[model samples]
Target: MTLILAHRGYSAEYPENTMLAFREAAKAGADGLELDVQMTKDGELVVIHDEKVDRTTDGTGFVKDYQLKDLLKLDARFKFASLPNREPIPLLKEVLEWLAGTDLICNIELKNTLFMYEGMEEKVIEMVREFRLTDRIIISSFNHYSIVKSYMLAPEIEIAPLLSDGLYMPWIYAQSIRAKGFHPHWRAAQDEIVISSLDSGVEVRPYTVNKDNELERFFRVNCSAVITDDPVNARLIREKTKQA
Candidate 1:
């Protein structure tokens, strides 16, 4: 059966990457959680999707500009005004502490593609190891070099490359980089790509798979997992496809 990973943690309903979102995703029965990680000005690993907080929070400017203390003051409940609580941007350590208590797998996307934060991989890997959650963590990045560096640092943990465009024979590319999995755009994860990759023991997990048809298709094909904003709906669809 295909696993359901909540993209940014049930983001379709809650603010993306918030603790509230992650908690809700767990309650919704997602098999895992997918989140983005970027370093702060003070060298703290914080979880947020964008380099800038303008889109996701009430703050302006880049995340790297703010120290973790200052960044926590901003409300992360962007566009969710009726949510009835101020959602502070969570520290990666805080999230990991929370995750250590749960059985859900975590796909931590290193948000270092745009700004190559020095020592970002080392910091993230060290934190994961500190929590003893290396086995349950999958470190991914759009920066393939960052992914390679992560793999070299901790080969025991699973590492996947995030691809926005179609990469021909992604499994082969992944092997070249020593990646154990592939996280591609849903469109890039074609039937042949998915099936062949899985057959060769490479995990194929597509991102932002929200539509019912797409959910059913990936589930039916038995891909490793689907990273989705609507994990609740995806879980239901997975059950339905399994029954069919």
Candidate 2:
């Protein structure tokens, strides 16, 4: 069966990266949780998916511009639809602390380039080591420099280079950085491209897959895994589809 990795926790059930969302994802039996990170102005590694806070939270500014203390004050909600007491944006350490002694895997994707956090690669590596999760963590980034910098700093953490349409032959690019896997947007997973990566011993897992038919297509072609926004639905589909 294809491994089902949750994209930013069970984002559909709770706000992405919030403690509630991550707990929901773990409860849903996700094989791994994928989250994004950005360094705050005060040098704390915060778990958030955007450069700015306006969209996902009740705030309006770049995350880089705010100190971690200020960022915590904003309400992180999925609109006003969530249960009144459901969640808040969780610190990366808080997530790690929660994950301690559990078997859930994690993939932490860097939202900004290495330049944004200067020495962020080392900082992230240090945290993963501090948490003693080197074997279970996959560090990834859409920015090519972040990918390369991560590989240079911590080869122990599995690296996956995320690519969108802007880049072609991304398999080659991933290999150049010694990436353990290739995480491309589902639309970018052309047949030859996936096969080329697989042939080179690099697994390819497409991101944010939402439909059964689309997932079946990739599975038929031997793609490694599917990162999804709804892991509970994906797991059900995977079980039923396999039986079919």
Could you say which candidate leads in lDDT?
1
lDDT of 2 by residue, 1-244 (tens): 5788888889977788788888889899998889988888888888889888888888898888888888888888856455677355678888887876679888889887634677678888888899999998888887867878887888888899887763576767777788878888998887788888789888888998998787777766777788999999888887777776
lDDT of 1 by residue, 1-244 (tens): 7999999999999999999999999999999999999889999999999999999999999999999989999999999989999999999999999999999999999999799999999999999999999999999998999989999999988999999999889999999999989899999999999999999889999998999999999998999999999988998899999999
Candidate 1 has which clashing residue pairs, if any?
none
- The residue-level lDDT of candidate 2 at 130 comes to 92
Candidate lDDT scores, in order, read 0.94, 0.82
Q: Cα lDDT for residue 151, model 2? A: 77
Where does candidate 2 stray beyond 4 Å? 166-169
Cα shift from native, residue 156, model 1 (Å): 1.1
The weakest ten consecutive residues by lDDT in model 2 span: 78-87
Native-vs-model 2 lDDT? 0.82
